[model samples]
Target: MEQPHFKSWPDVAPTLIAVAAGRAPADTVIRGGQWVNVHTREILPDHDIAIAQGRVAFVGPDASHCIGEGTEIIEADGRFMIPGLCDGHMHIESGMLTPAEFARAVIPHGTTSMFTDPHEIANVLGLDGVRMMHDEALMQPVNIFTQMPSCAPSAPGLETTGYEITPDDVAEAMTWPGIIGLGEMMNFPGVIHADPKMLAEIAATQRAGKTVGGHYASPDLGPDFAAYVAGGPADDHEGTCEADAIARVRQGMRSMMRLGSAWYDVETQITAVTEKGLDPRNFILCTDDSHSGTLVNDGHMNRVLRHAISCGCDPLIALQMATINTATHFGLEREIGSITPGRRADIILTSNLTDLPIEHVIARGKTVAMDGKVMVDCPHLDWPDHARRTVNLGPARRAEDFVITAPEGANRVTANVIGVVENQAPTKALTADLDVIDGAVAGDADKDICQIALVERHLGTGKTVNGFVSGFGYTGDMAIASSVAHDSHHMIVVGTSRDDMAKAANRLGEVGGGITVFKDGQEIAMVELPIAGLMSDSPVSEVAAKAQDMVDAMAACGCHLNNAYMQHSLLALVVIPELRISDLGLVDVTKFELTDVIKGSA
Candidate 1:
């Protein structure tokens, strides 16, 4: 049997018209519900909806006339009938699950639409990698729109990706059926300075009539920001404050407030809509990244909506932010974002607006989930052998390979460290004085400082650049290693013991690619992400369980930061702010230059 999808209004319009006029029977009829109309911002009582051929045909005070012997009737019983939730922006790979598994996980939570950026896979596999993601996403029962990745290195010249995306790639991707637009342009400096590659990608997207995403990570809303806006990104999800949200909307960019597994940015920016007088239409909600554990335990867009409502946003307004506003932004308002006639029959039933318990979910006129359990099958593609062998650790390692050699005969030195900020994407550039032992600079776990290294993974260089990081609060002879490093997709290993670090890195190499934790020279937990070294094609529940074990391992090592694995993966993202590690070395992102990890050593 074929998976059902919306075939556009024209393909089903005649049937829809016949069903509404009682000349043909509806496939399904939902009766006696409180219609939560997002377009009019009203909750009208005793409404009915008739669905046929996966599209809405009639929505009025009564739809009983369209029901026949073959129609499936759902008695809403006064439950609130709202349009299915939509995620304005996200990355499917961040969940550590492929598109099929991700769809299965979120269907129970009533997320019917997702606008995803596959930049993580793009950094590891280039244009072909994006195409693979697109094809699998189209196979899902939900709407999973892919955005062509715009930046592979994220910050060119600072790091090298496995494969770079070209303007020709952008032009070619625009023709794909599932390609919604260009992904987040992380090279704000390039855009502001008029870099040819950045402008060309933007121009190609605009010429193809697609949306261009934005990522202005800087706090500055100055002329540089104006230039970036002029360079043409239609929306931004990197805003961290009320001012940032206001500034983006003022410059005609949609301000997307995100609440991912690690990023809790909604409360600060929702003030732009809840308190300030900005039009709510320009404010949107998203989850830039959510690991499997978060998606399984907490929720998806439903969690974000509950958070927004708790933060003083009206329920209707919050739903609009996640629904019609996102739909209208992607130019998809006519198709999937609402419960109006001519739109796909995607909806959710909930008893309360505040708590938002997802009671039932319908997509493409079919009941996919009921009471927190998915009833439909989400399928996966058969991955080839090459896709499972992305982690390329070049050579054998020793404890000495993880060592950061200090200056000749030095006892102590001041070193620049990457400081983790809890629940945020930005890191602080910090400095700490550390002890030197046997001509090697050693991290003091007592001071919450540990050795951080970025290993060259893609091209099989045995090179590793070592630095220091704080805020994990790790103790004992423990190490945490991952191949899911952001943007550049390198190997990041952080540990208090050099031997354990070497062990963790080697284990990832042995498994092809994954995350691992080691302590007392034994493996404590592991999650194997063999696909592009970034995702697992396993069930989301299995992955989330292992992820929970990973969380427990991090906590057992005496490290406690909310979603520390997310912070661990982002240590290699050099485009965001302050300090980061790349294949080159420690990057002072504010200055956009590479500097010595040891203070004054340069």
Candidate 2:
């Protein structure tokens, strides 16, 4: 089938006239609506949008000329017509669905574009996984652009990835039709120090004239920050404070404030524009890692927009942050950000400007969603068998695997614990005194402390690093297991009882790869993430429903950390601050070094 393209308003004027005159040949024409022009931040009333052949042709006061028989005329009832939202930064695997399914989940939320990085999957399944995600994204009805993962191991020496992405990979991927730029370069220390590999990758992305993503996740806004700015990253989304946001924009970087499933960074950072009086154009909205629950139950980019507005930002500025600003950041301003000529006819009709109630959504000039229901088919990809079967436990993990042996004849000891922050991406480094039993240290659930272990699943190494975590508040005989551990994508299991931990890990292995909760030696909830142990082939709503059960299971165990699954996945990520676990060992992320959980600090 030959796809249609639009050039100018004049070319679509006749079709618009036909639609208004009840003689249009277009697929759909929305009439008598107020257009919320995100480009100029204006709401122009009495506008009509003419969509035909899956691309918008005319948007004007009247579309009575291009109308012919069989044209669908939609009366907007004087509502607000706005551009469909765009996510400036995200990860598809974090949603635990393939790109096609992810698109299907967010279409009803009025998200017409997404800039995703498949680096998490790349770390688990390599470049082949990136290709798989990219191909499926192109098949979606809405825009799903990819950023070639810049950091595979994320922190090179901190941990090992299943696959490594080189400078050559970035250069080669630049020619792919759907690749927008380089993914978030998580190696901030490497970039500041001018590491050869990181510099080479940045050079390749620059040579291709694509934007380079940044991640300077530190509180130090000193010389190191300057060094990172000189390293050529165009934008950063790790800012969590007003100072962080102000510094990034001052250093010629776009300040990307994100509102993910667990990351509530928008409110804290949007003050850079709302109070500090910075240029709003340099700010962007992104959902760095939103799970399917947030997408199906809450919203996607629309959620971010609402959060930005609630943080005292102007409604128009919030809309721009989710629209034209994001499009310009990725160099897609001419393609999908605005309602101007030559762009994809992706737009939304809403009832309220501040609340932004999405009533109708049009993608590429075709009405794809109406009243929160998808009206089209979102295609799926045939995932290979290798992606489904990834959990490799070299041997059975015994209770001894989780026992932290004390020094010599030491009876009890003080240990550094990784404290999970609720509904936030950052963790707190905490210390606690524990009682030793039978020459091994055990978790004190009364103090809200539990055992956390990271089992290396990449090469059947069978290496397990044992540690303790607080703030989960888990009591009794319950354990949680997940293969979505971040960065290296290893399996992380936390429990007060060693037997339950082993059972949970074993069940995931039995199901190929998934999350399982066990209490009293019985399974309570499970979600099969058969694709690279990070995503599922099932519909997002189904996965989301199961995810709710997993949440309930955690709560039933007497744990009360908000969105603790997010905290669970990040336990293995060595990039974020305070303390973390990895295949290598427990990492003191602030110092970027391996430290023992019990004593022997530094």
Candidate 3:
């Protein structure tokens, strides 16, 4: 089904004027509702809204005059009528589903608008991948604006991508339909150092009057942070603390506090508005990455808004953060993010403000969902077979491919381990002492340490970089592998047994791309993501069910971390802090270079 094209204000002005003046009938009349006016931050009761030509024509104490025989009347029964929720920043591919499936999952949660960055696809398939995502996003019933991916490799010299996006690519994408802005500029060092490529991408977005997303992942609030902000990213979601949020807003940048499936950043940063008295207008709520399970079971923007309220933010203020604040940041305030006249008729009905329950959702004057069930069709693009065949691990990996050799005569050594921080993106730089068995390093399950390997899948390079990671708490002879590794989209296999590790890695290659868990040399659970090895072609419910099973399989193996699969997928994300693994070797993300896994050992 083709989505209704957005009507310009001028095109709908005549009908809107006629409806407001009672000279014409409205297409839909919602009566007996409490309007949540985000502009004035007020909840005025007994309000009525008249919509015409997919836009709000009139909203006031009564719209009875605008109602006619042909008008569809919705009796709200005094429920809170709030503008549809908007995601300030997100990734559709993170849900492990295609754009259509992702929208189907979130629309029931009242998320009518999203500003998405398809950089995940850009890494694996380059500009063609971005265009595919963009075309599909426009076909969805809800507003899904595309931001041309700015960072494919994320950090130029630190990592390698399947395809590289250039300045010309960014410039060309800015002119594409539905292209809102540039994706997150993750290379903070590049921006601070005024790298030509980073600046050129930022300049192109600015020249086209588009917003530039930011990802300054450092905790240092010193000169480097200042220089990065001065380089031109208008918003950031990488802030994890109240101070980080405060600094961003103080420097004229929107501090986007995110609460994805694994990321719990809103609680720590919402205090900036609740306690520190930062203007709520400069603060936005987003889900930088939410898996399919979270979208299907836990809810989307409604989940974030409720969490913010529980963090001591006023209910209406929290709503504003997810709605008007986000829309205004993107310069789309007048077109969306409000229940006022002339804006798109995207609204939600809820009985309570604190524990917000989405009873009904209307997008573009059409009721798309009601009571947790999506009513409208989210159109899908014909994803070709080439997009599905992304994993190309040159040769069959063997148990020997995952081995970590120790120094010639060393019996024990200290190894740099990637420590997974629970509910946060940044990993802790940690070290552990391990014994050498047969000139090979052994993992200590008692200490929550496991072996990690990065298998090169882009160039058919069959290279595996081995390292150690903590915090999975796995104690069995099991392995987990995923091709959804962030930024570079390589394969990350973590396990206690090299045999199981190799089994899991090869299984992913056999399936073209997906996440798989192997226990005792047998597959326990798996989700086949044929689309760029990062997303599935299945329906959202099917993908969510498989993802939930993957989580259960991990827990069954004594691996217990909130969304451990998400942590597993990010092990190769070389841009994040502390430590990571890549095709080259183990990366010291703090230093942005490859370093030895075993310290002080040749």
Candidate 4:
């Protein structure tokens, strides 16, 4: 079914004016609620909101004049009425669900608007994939704006994607409906060094009068950062410290502090607002990459808001950061992010401000969710079979395919290992001494080191780049493989035994695409993400259940890093520092170049 198209303020001004003047009765009246006015940053008690033609007609001390016999009355009972929450930056595919399923999952959590980047699918299927995501987003009950993906390989020359997004692609996408802006420019160095393609994409977005999303992953706050800020991106979410937040805000860029499944970056950077006296309006709350389990069990933007409050932010201020501040960043404040006249009647009814219990949610003057349940259907797209079958790991992989051959005569070798940092996106570059067994480097389980391989899944190359990773705490003959590897969407297989690694890789291929875990030659757990090998077509509840089981299986194998699955998928991400594996080889992201895994052999 087609969702209602949002009417412009001019188109609905007549009806809204009629209802406000009591010349015509309103369609709905929410009475006896405290208006949490974000514009004034104060709560006004005993206000009545009148809605007409899916837009807020009036919000004042009383709406009795606008009410008639046919008007539907909802008694707010003195509850706090705030604008529906908005996520400034997120990737819907990260939730392991389609756009429709993601909206269905978060509507009950009070998130009525989202600015999402479909770059995950773009890496797998290119421009066609982005169009599919945009088409589905337009059919949702709540706001789901699509940002044309800016970086597919994330960093050209550093990584390879199944499809490359060109400047022409960005220009064409800007003309499409629902294209809010260009997605996060993950190639910080490219923008800093003035790469022609990156600049052209930003130029296209600016020419279209759209915001450009930023992702400066580097820790440097020097001239390079200054150059990047001058390149025209408006926001940054890769900040992990107070200094990072302060630097971005000082440069006139909004600092987006994310609290996703594995990235706990809010507590560290929110201090820029809590203690450092930085302007809170310059900060926003978002979930850059949340798993389905986090959305179902914890919350969406609500989770990030609560975390901000716990870190010493005022509840009202936090709400503004999640609502108006976000909408203003995308130039959408007049259309959303407020409980004012001439705005979409997207409001949430909650009893407490601090805890933020979403008792009821109304979107576009219609009650869409009540008592943690969705009242409307989130329409789905008919994804073709070719999109579902994306895991093309040419020719069956074998144990020999994952073997890391040592140098000609080395008995002991110091190898560069990608050290996974818990609750962060950046990895630590560490060195490990491993014994060479029959001219092959072996993983030392006692030392918490495991073999990580990047199997090229996009093209039928059948090439596997092997390296070592630490911090998963795995200590058995277990292996985990996923087609949800970030940026490039290659297959990442980490395991102790080569046999188990091969089994896990083949299992994902056989299942079309998904995450799978194997132990002692037996499949322990799996979650099939048949859509582009990055998301499932199932309901969020079903996906969350399977994800929980996958987490349990990882724990059973002695892997105890919080949300280790996220870490595993990012092992192949070549954009973030300091060490990562890609289809090319071991990459030292800090240097933005592929380096040898064996320290002294190459």
For residue 401, model 4's alpha carbon misses the true position, in angstroms, by: 0.6
Candidate 3 residue runs with Cα over 4 Å from true position = 1-5
Instruction: Give the better candidate number (1 or 2) by lDDT.
Output: 1
lDDT of 4: 0.93
Prediction 3 TM-score vs. true: 0.99
Residue-level lDDT tens digits of model 3 in 160-186: 899999999999999887999999999
How large is the C-alpha RMSD of every model relative to the true structure?
Answer: 1.3, 2.9, 1.2, 1.2
Clash count, candidate 1: 0
Candidate 4 Cα deviation (angstroms), residue 490? 0.6
Q: How many clashes in candidate 3?
A: 0
Model 2 C-alpha lDDT per residue in residues 1-602, reported as the tens digit of each score: 11124244456556545544556566767889998888888989998877765556677888766555766888888998888899999999888888988998999989999999899989988888888889888888888989999998999889988889888888888889888899999999999999999999999989888999998889999999999999999999999999999999999999999998899999998988899899999999999998888889999999899989989999988999999999999888877787765567798888987887878988888788999999988878889999887888788788778888877677778999999998887799999888888988878877899999998787778888899999988989988999999988889999988989989888888887778999988999999998999999798889999998998999999877667888899998898898999988889999999998899422
Tens-place lDDT digits, model 4, residues 184-302: 99999999999999999999999999999999999999999999999999999999999999999999999999999999999999889889888899999999999999999999998
C-alpha positional error of residue 598 in candidate 1 after TM-score superposition, expressed in Å: 0.9
- Kindly provide the TM-score of model 1 when superposed on the true structure, using C-alpha atoms: 0.99
In candidate 1, what are the lDDT values of residues 378-400, reduced to their tens digit? 97888888888898888966789
| Displacement of the residue 185 alpha carbon in candidate 4, Å | 0.4
Off by over 4 Å in 2: 1-27, 600-602
